[model samples]
Target: MKKHIFTLFLLFNSLVLLAQESYFPERNAVWEQKSSSDFKIDSEKLNAALDFAKDNEYSGSRDLRIAILKGFEREPFHEILGPTKKRGGPAGMILKHGYVIARWGDTKRVDMTFSVTKSFLSTTAGLALDQGLISSTKDKASDYIWDGTFGGEHNSKITWEHLLQQNSAWSGELWGGKDWADRPPREGDIDDWKFEKPKESGTFMEYNDVRVNVLAYALTHVWRKPLPQVLKEHVMDRIGASTTWRWHGYDHAWTEIDGLQMKSVTGGGHSGAGMFISTEDMARFGLLFLNDGKWKNEQIISQNWIQQAIKPSEPNVNYGYMWWLNRKGDRYWEGLSENIYYAAGFGGNFIVVDKENDMVIVTRWLEPNKIGEFMTKLKEALD
Candidate 1:
């Protein structure tokens, strides 16, 4: 009788675990508030987390829009494809089990997510791979880009994986921007940048926006359609993202595709005008990835693709594809799982996803370095 009771106990525990619904909010899902007691969260710790985010908010340039344009090469900035937009202040929402636990500032205000746009760019590549638009990640990028872009022998050796991992070291100009000029080393002068030897593809991991833009251009040629449309039809709309988000490219980035002049969207807003999206839409995106590219039982981005995208590349362990990983003590925090990964951008925009705790923390302008502190305190609140 005791043995039978033990069997029944195991069955009951399994059922309980299965009964817990994995929340996926609808297009009109409201931010229904619940007491800390209901979610087993520490009220004190929760308040502390909120306080930390509020206190250490983004204290950068107040007019980043004007400042960013002035900082870059003026002529090229003016020649870029799309118009730049103004940015907003510190704001974000913390979602636990698909419900907003805490939100601060203006969560609905759309803002430039900087390099966080790389994560979306990476997702587009995942979609391409899923639909067999490209055969494999290891395939030579030159195979798809028949144009003289990857003409040189060195650049020809670059693979899709190399580009996605930011180790391609792809040379040549795209949309009037030189590879070296993208993000030159701070210590170096123009001559130093001009003379620097380029590393072999997949060897060095330099965060160059030009190389990233090159990846965007190559993907554009493959799809023969604008990236924003691909994203909206496949991923964003399915995930219930708002129409406020806009992916902008430069002025000269336009090309005649399928008899129409289409702009090749950029990977980020390095030069200006990248993904201007709201925190709520960003949360939905984070939730999609947290559930491994599935939305309401449909596989939007392949699970295999996501697994590959997140794995640590040999060049940089803390970076996978375009997403930032928490491996090797980078972005590590106590009381949080080591598997935590996030989409980080310039000016402290972050969409931090913790799969273990089923949480997605979106913060805009929260002081880049202080993210670890904020997350550490926030995780402690989850009890």
Candidate 2:
């Protein structure tokens, strides 16, 4: 009898966990942003933001140092920031009835943004497109690149469109299998990728790290400045991100398009990881992008660049340059348009831009609900 009861209890816990993971409590969510009578925002939804902020540690900047000794690396999360300092969440908090509008957890603080760095890189490519530097997106990326594999039969047909879309069917051991984990985590980050055979290219959209490195090679080789410097002038500096945040190429400078000193990218690298900024500042970026790359009447990132960056290039998997699109339901939710896009990172770091509603939501945390769950929640909120 006790065994049966234990099995039942375990089953119940499993069901609850599954529910939290898959089933979203939509009606229970509310908004709280009220104060501005001019803006067409749901006061109740804004109120929900207020309630969300009560729990997270967003009122402070956490610091941490990673030192190497004894041939090992040591990192402590809670102790990194050395006890959190006091900070106001954000002016007119959206979670708690229009009080604070910002949040930051340990992971969101000093942690690195891995694949996110790609978004920045792609944005630079957009600027190049808008500035008339690259001319057109149709040109094969291999023309500017100088790799043997890129020139071979399959890759020769691949275009810039393919690389940005991750649709480049470059033949490598990485994408030719089902268990991607068995292949190296990153070809550019470390020497873990075990490449064996080569096959046809530009067939499917699979996550490829080395493809980004190839893009860096193409862009930086043409621009004549390292990808980091190009990013500084084209994206970061324009976005008012002079903060300590920055991008790092790779340790193998020969293989890396941009290289200076060897160090972990401040917050994260590009792609899944990259430039780190305060959640407040990150929201500012989204605000600028949502408003067509202008802030206080200054054309930071060109309007053309903004459109090219967020505008969907293809509908295969719903991606534009480096941003992701909402998958479920209609495009218009609440006052937001279907054109809304987001910069998502591992561990639930999100920078959402809803141009239709003039809303830019940014969330940073070591952990949040699962990726799909959180995105669905935000979509539901807008809907």
Candidate 3:
């Protein structure tokens, strides 16, 4: 009887702690802020970290069209196939226990978020799994997508898990972008890459925009609607995200679904047209993940999916289901928690979730190379 009472007491304390961390902002409402001292964070150190982020802006043209072309200069035939935007100055927010502890620059400015859209793409897949639209991740893509995209024998073996992990090695052209041409290895010419034997679906990992778009396309067919709609209905609205955000696809990516035309969105802005969102919305998304897919009393996404999404895939210890893990791998950040996972895009946009610290850090237009040092300083502030 005494042990039972003790267990109940611990459970009660846990509930109280959760209530303390449950603050979430309403739509268009002023987000509540708390001082660094309120959370026992060193204000001086926190300011230093923010200053570091401000001092190191992304060294790219504000005109993203030029930035995209120049950044992917090595990739043959790479061009802006969709909409591009002129980015705002460096912006970000630091959320501690779902409350803003620090903010900088133009957090309200909506800008193109490049590959960070992959994380959002993967979230749609997670939603599908939760809703029983997808039975299992281990199921073969060909089983669901009977279209010629997965018709070939090699492609037929590609599973949803493989695609989510970016190990599918799906070789094909989608929306005028060829898999071989997306990001050809520096060591090889176009002829060599195009003629090279396709790696097994689950064996090799290659970051190809074409393959990522293929996942988006497949998910669209499965969901029977535009992915942005699914996200807005099930996620953004529930999380109180602003309506200014937009998800776009290539101009030619239209498809007939249920007797109506819908555009299949890209997983990233490699060829343009992905998620264009404000920093605050990105923070809300990050907060949802930090809380393990819950918003107040509602479970927006299943906890099981969140767990699987963050688990490192065998091909890359630093990558999960479209999320970048801070494991001691090629992309690992020195002096940060191994549990830190993030949504990273080109031009240094990132939504970093530090679960151990109950914090989410959104940094836009910071130098990509300086993230490690920035994170180290942020961690020091917490200490």
Candidate number achieving the greatest TM-score relative to the actual structure:
3
lDDT agreement of model 2 with the native: 0.49
lDDT of 3: 0.93
lDDT of 2 by residue, 1-383 (tens): 99999999979865663343111112112322234333323446544543453344322232212211110121111122111112223221122121223333421233444455667677667767777777777788667666554676777877777777666755532112222222233335322333434333445555555565556556665675666676676655655553555466444333333553322221223222245555544554565676676655567677866666655544343566777665334332333346668776643456777554445666654233333333344444444
Model 1 residue 54 lDDT score: 79
Q: What is the TM-score ranking, best to worst? A: 3, 1, 2
In terms of lDDT, the best-performing candidate is 3
Give the TM-score comparing model 3 with the true structure, all chains together.
Answer: 0.95
Candidate 3: pairs in clash: none
- Which runs in model 1 stand beyond 4 Å of their true positions? 1-19, 69-82, 329-335
Number of backbone collisions per candidate: 4, 45, 0
Where model 3 places Cα greater than 4 Å from the true spot, the runs are 1-19
Q: Distance (Å) between predicted and true CA of 292, model 2?
A: 1.3
